[model samples]
Target: MATISEATSAPASEAEALAFARRVLRDEARALAAVRDRLDGSIVRASRLVHDCRGGVIVTGMGKAGLVGQKTAATLASTGTRAYPLHPAEAVHGDLGRVRDGDVVLAFSQSGETEEVLRLLPTVRRIGASLVAITERAASSLGRAADVCIAMGNVPEACPLGLAPSASTTAMMAVGDALALLVARMREFTPEDFALYHPAGNLGRRLTRVEDVMRTGRDVRLAAPEESVRQVFIRLAGPRRRSGAVLIRDDRGMLLGIFTDSDLVRLFEKRREDELDRPIGEVMTANPLRATAGAMLGEAVELMKARKISELPVVDAEGRLLGLIDVTDLIGASPEDFEE
Candidate 1:
């Protein structure tokens, strides 16, 4: 029996270890290139088959191949293909009834001869559905039975003994990703589409709009032209459950300038104690760069970065005060979604 010591001692030098890693990556890349070049008719047909499915693509495999199959199904589903996994063992028991004529069966088997996989092929065909097999040999049972066989070719195992399924699995994953991406491009899936599928993710929250995160109703920072400087200072600084600056507007629905903590401090530094009693219009910055309520979060960040401004006012299309978007709020968001 092989042991961990035998496997550990196989690669005698760091150079050999590095070479093995590179070899696996290079071979997998080559497999992807081959698939790309060969995507002429088979990929189109397979994609169309999945697209036209009345049910959805039912992916199946066994062992390590099953893990890869699960990921492939998810990628397909996320990228516009209606795909889900069906375990080989479970299919044989009773799940075979789930296979419909309008559905496509995508089977993954590195060896192409996995008994569990071979046993499901007849039942897959019995339902009058299409099968797209991803395997290493064209002559293998699964490969030959599939209506569209995507031969992954002979990817040499990274294991020195040719026992572990290293390069084969990587090649399968690459093929799956390539197909998912192509189908996504074909269907013109956008980041907004991805956001719908992945709403609980960080990208979803970061992509969320000013209307989603901004305060409204009684919690909003609002003011009027007749407000005194002392009240504006209290609203803009120190405490209010929210911070940065306060949004001020005239009674006519026109936006007045904002009064930040900086403006308050600067005013106190330059004025007499009695001068603090002046109206807020004296200290507020007039005509600040403002945005609309429906503006994308990404665009808002860009405007902030360009103007070197920390706070921005949100208004309606006709220029009515809506709310405020802060640099600190965007900073709390992820850096990924904010990038172009």
Candidate 2:
């Protein structure tokens, strides 16, 4: 039972400090595992309530619980469920109007007796909105008033003083996440649906389709396989920025091969300039790696990395070139960039 000053004043080795930190994390992890094991019918009931809700899900709490509720609401909203955070204190000041009939209100309070949270219950019920409570005690006032009560069983604080909320808030947040994700799964949420919510950041860049960023139409340099390399280069040379490769196609527009600036350099270095006047197909790389228009940019990047190529032709089901994906376009991308 050391005071804050006493704890700070005591000299502890790095090992001691690391051990203490590990203990705190272990305690919280154990508490979460306990909550997971003890989950009962209440979770099912809560999920059903949210899934059947025709209107948005309204989440509210006070203090740390409120912060967790806000994050939970955001998770739900981004995963296809309509949800928003309503501050309990603000609810009394007319913000309660944000709640409507058919909305499912989720209230988070470790104690289940938070005054501000309890004060808003009656109004939430009167609005014809169903109430769900996440608390440590299902028998507490907030639980009793709720249509469904999700109990966080006997979570002890990781704080040595047992006064500050620690393990309890962690368990509450975990439960909130579980509910949100379960509801998302019940609604059969897809990655496309997730992308719609997150259209910025690295996530957006990873989810972007090849067609979205690829060079198409006049921007693509296409040449017949029988065309001379010199003729192809002359046609491709212009003031506009260009891709490093030329797509070789047949009269039916089917992709046959690809000729790149690198190939031209190799030809000159090997003194094979005479071959350039022959059919470009004779020197071009045949059956090059390609992607589809609907494929993710990340996928095209992986293919390019594995094959050690800079350009990937985007084709349709019939192998007709739709566009080209350049490695420079995805220069900064990584495997982790595509993870949800």
Candidate 3:
């Protein structure tokens, strides 16, 4: 056994440490590239088995592979496939009841011989569930037992001692992701479908539609192009939160221009309080940037940022005003958060 100091001893130099880190990354990347090249009929078969299953996918593994299995299951579930992770150790201890007929079991074991995972194979078959094994060696027990075996192609471990699971686990994760994403593409999974599963993070905010976040109905500050600025301000003032800009529309309900509180301040500063009594169209911004109600909230945010504007109007095909999206609503949002 090694002491903490011995275990964490410094390398010859910082450069050597960085070189070692880079080598580890390069080794793992090479493993993934090899796995990618090795992908063949087995992957397609595994994907089809899971996709056609009447029951949800059950992902099972032991140790580090178990952690990777959980992530794989989560990715599948989020991408429109029903999936859940199962611990092989727990499955033998009565949790095997989770398996059911017509279900697909994805077992992860780099060497294809993890005892816990292998032990569950017979029970999985007994339950009438199909098994898909992901491993480096197709000749191993688990691989032979599986209905389909996805070979990871033997690769050198990133660990110097070749004891820790590094390159193999990375390849397994990459393969799992490939299968899930391919299935998603085959099912024509849409962003809306993804949003349904991820509704509580930056992803949710990005996927949110303009209609879901915009101020609509009476909450929208509306003004006729010909209405006096004074009249528009009086009508817009109230206990309810008011948008910074008032949407100016024509009698036919088509958007004409936008008048903001900033315009009012400018009027006062210019000693043109008399303009407050003038038609609001005289001081309003005409042909402002706008979004459709069905447009993504992130798209609206991007438009606002690019145009250096604080408010965006939601309109219909005929330019009818539907609602308003305020910059304050997007205060905490970041551009990177919206990238797919």
Candidate 4:
């Protein structure tokens, strides 16, 4: 066999290389469109089977199709369905035990005759799992064995050699996404549900509830509206995490205003130490910007950026203070959160 550097020739020119790349992309795009046009009731039936599955979905395929299957399984799992990718070869080698009765097996085979994929169908059926096939022809053995077949019609590979899996795998992924998203819609999967599944990424952090990230209990310094500023500071002082502001609330627990360290500093900047003995509400920013407990942390960040405030108090429907979202609390917040 010739080494890669020995067998391959350099590109004639950048322009020619660019043109070839465009041709490949156009070919794949056209093939994908053809697959889209060929979609039929089979996809709907497959979606219904996946949506109604009592057990998890088990996606299986071989080679390139197996790679597509892994992505498809992840999409399904993230969008509210329980899904796992099982290698066809591994399925026969003890992984078949993962399949249960009432489970749906989604198998991908561009040629509809992948030996390993075909081998798993009998045991899957024996386990009482329904099979859904994605292939080039509905008449193929995998399709014939499936409860419903989503035919990819005829997708030509974009490779010049016409052997590599390109457009076919793309078509498989597109169809898999359609099936997964359709079922997610059927289940009415909400953003909150998605957030629960994705709890560590930027998306998860943005969708986090204000109450979940806010400083509650003693971490939040709540001062009564009637308290004097001098007394408020002395009482709120502790070794706990210091918040920049003191939330002023009425006797009934209704938030009234906010008095920040900035406010105190300004008071002492001039000869106004005597005013510290006055009621804190008289000097506080009354009816300050606030967020509700149910609001997302992203919305609170936007509010903070717009208002140029660092501390935002969270309240309930009746305006009782629940917690505070200080700038310190948003330590790992995205740069966009701090942008004006």
Candidate 5:
């Protein structure tokens, strides 16, 4: 009944278009209100099903609900819920096998009469999987067959003609987000845990480790405490390393402190210039911060930020020095790690 251009656009000024959008948002608010006011025993039962689901969750829908289902599936998967989207059409082909008895199925539809979604309802029940439905009418096909029906109360469609799907899809998305977040919180979903699921995103780098960025092997500044300031300066200042010479115990080769050219002025200011002749113990920082080789760099930044230090030594869990890190040295680390 409509041309491609007409389908793509509506004839109206920008202000009129904005008014239509406002009306749609109002309808969405009403839909959210209705869903909240009508929530009953079904919500508790559905939550229980989700809690018991060891095999994870599968959310399915048709039409607009199907698009919302994809976002819901992705959110749940990212938030430690182990969820995936199962298209109603694809279920008939072979995707039905993805659902096991231990999985929870969430079916969403405004009219609850989508033939694609309804067709999968019987097999979902026959397979012994628990089902939860979200729809306006409790007696709707999908609603009636569900193990638990979430009543989507009477919120008029955002379409002025009351034909297009708008508010219903928004309400369904809110419900999906609520369920995912509730379950994720119950499981104590931490940033570190979430990073495993989102390794390529900014969140993953925010949880990155010091070992991932610190200078390793030959690039690390390591030397005995007994080394001459001249010899240490040759190795440290010669290479233009951000970190100065690190002093380790001569006997066990364990880290003790660090000595930098910055310390030279202060030493010459207070004591004789010849005192630089002493072992690094007298000239180096006696109590330097040491980090375990595997500690998160984000946490290390917190330490450095609080202490206002430029560089720190990396040590093993047993307190043996492995390498060092500096704020300037952060350039070699992943770029995503620096994001706010």
Candidate 6:
């Protein structure tokens, strides 16, 4: 028999250590593949049940399975299905009240015999909430009681001692994600809907509309195409916020061109101060790159990065000036967002 230290000892070589890690990964991958192969109408039925459920989903499990349940619940909620995680142990102590008629109770248990999880079966049934089980066999107490059973089959653990919940939990998480996403698909959830649920992270920022972040009103420097370059700059100099580019608009409020401060420096470099008094339109970049009003901020960022410009004009369908997107406005964006 191996002693605890012997079982936990570091590999004699780096190659050996890497091999063990790779083997563990392979084991988990195989487990997921097996679960995928076993999938049939049960998944479709479970997804439909959850999709049609009028009340929110109540996910319950124990220990590591409970942790997976929490993540599953979060995924479901973010995907447009309202869901909440309830610890099976806590349920017996009054959390069971969270389950109610019209709700779907999603229970997770590898053995299908976790005492805490199984104890909730009777109460869940009594409350009239439909039970959906993610377990190993249909004969298991939890599975037999479920209206829908997504049997994952028996997945061997990836742990060296074969005692930890590694592979099984991985399979459980994947199955949970599959079910949640299927329901999301059934609901025809859109990116706009997804953005509503994730409004604080990198994802939310990337999904933000150009118009939502673009500089508008007095903050945007709009100049008449007939105005002289010198006059446009002079008029825009006193605004509380300064934009790098001045949008040249026709009398009808349509965008004609864009002139940046860099254009002024170029005039000085070329000894063209004489042209500063000319109509700014001739010196401005005509038909400049622009983003549509409802376009995503990420699309604007990609355009600005690709064009290597510091400003992008936001316009409506008829080419009417809406606002401006300054590079400074995206300083808080993730480095990945700027990647091609």
Best by lDDT: 6
What are the models' TM-scores?
0.81, 0.93, 0.92, 0.94, 0.75, 0.95
- Residue 105, candidate 2: how far off, in angstroms? 1.0
Cα lDDT tens digits for candidate 1, 42-153: 6667666666667788999998898899999999887767888999999999999888987889889998999998999888888888898888887998888998887777
lDDT of 6 at 202: 72
Better of 2 and 5 by lDDT: 2
Clashes of 4: 0
Q: Mind giving the per-residue lDDT tens digits that candidate 3 earns over 196-304?
A: 7888789999998888888888877888888899888887777777578889999888999888778878888999988988899988999988998778888988888
On TM-score, the leading prediction is 6
RMSD versus native structure for model 2? 2.1
Give the Cα error of residue 319 in candidate 1, in Å.
3.7
Given candidate 5, what's the lDDT at residue 184?
A: 76
Local distance difference test, candidate 4: 0.90
What digit string (tens of lDDT, one per residue) describes model 6 on residues 1-340?
4466765898999998998899899999999999999988999999999999999899989999999999999999999999999998889999998888999999999999999999998898899999999998889999999999999999999887778999999999999999999999999999888878877767887787888889999988889988999898888777468678889999998999999889888999999999989999899999999999988788788788778899999999999999999988778784475343
Model 1 bad stretches (over 4 Å):
1-9, 97-101, 231-240, 250-256, 272-276, 298-310, 327-340
| Candidate 6, pairs of clashing residues | none
TM-score of 1: 0.81
| Cα RMSD for candidates in order | 4.1, 2.1, 3.0, 3.2, 5.1, 2.0
Q: What is the C-alpha lDDT of each candidate?
A: 0.76, 0.87, 0.88, 0.90, 0.75, 0.90
Residue pairs clashing, model 2? none
Candidate 1, run of 10 with poorest lDDT: 331-340
Which tens-of-lDDT digit does each residue in 282-322 have in candidate 5?
67887678788767676777677678777778878777777
What is the overall TM-score of model 6 with all chains considered together? 0.95
Candidate 3 versus the native: TM-score? 0.92
